[model samples]
Target: MTRTESLANRLQEVLLNGRWIANTNYKHQLEDITWEQAIKKVGSLNTIAALTYHVNYYLAGILNVFRGGELEIRDRYSFDLPPICSKEDWDNLVDEFLTNSEAFVLEVSKLPDHKLDMPFVDEKYGTYLRNLEGVIEHCYYHLGQISFLKKLIFA
Candidate 1:
């Protein structure tokens, strides 16, 4: 498969439905979690709701650039999730994440293989491949945290 297709699939593996990598995807991990459990604090670690919004924040920002918009996401604000006070709030965040995840995957899948080697946004950010891979890696990193937090909160 082309690099773009492969990257898109990897993204799916982490955020949506594939399970070969972490044995769990974001959808599987977040679907059953209630608003209370999502916002539960496990020691000093970030809540699942925060992490979910965090990853989706980047996905959405980067996805904007993919659609010809400028890069506008900042690391400091990645976790600035608004209060999820009810099931509706949590569900809305998950819905946004899922929508952004699907859109991100679609944008990546549509890219030309040659674009993978081209600079993403700017040279300093590295190639499209690098950014795409970074998103996948970043998601997995937080996914691990979310999974661990889930166990801790439930235990």
Candidate 2:
């Protein structure tokens, strides 16, 4: 498969549904979690809800760039999730995350292979391949945190 297709698959694996790497994807981990559980504090780490919004924040920002918009995400605001006061709030966040994840994957898959080497927004940010891989890696990193937090919450 082309590199873009492979990267898109990897992105899907971490964010949507593929068990080849972490053995758990974001969808599987967050689907059954209650709003209370999602906001539960597990020591100093970020809440599941925060992390979910965090990753989705980046996905959305980059996805916008993919659609020819400017990059507008800021790291300081990544975890600035509005309070999830009810089950409906948590569900909306998850639904938004899943929708953005799918859109991100679709954008990546649609890229021409040559675009992978092109600068992503700016040369300092590195190539499209680098940014795409970074997103996958970033998701897995937070996914691990969410997994561990789940265990801690239930323990």
Clashing pairs in 1: none
Indicate the residue-level lDDT of 127 in model 1. Answer: 95
Provide TM-scores for the models: 0.98, 0.98
Weakest 10 consecutive residues of candidate 2 by summed lDDT: 40-49
Off by over 4 Å in 2: none
lDDT of 2 by residue, 9-92 (tens): 999899889999999999999988999999998778899999999999999999899999999999989989999999999999
lDDT of each: 0.93, 0.93
Worst 10 residues of 1 by lDDT: 146-155
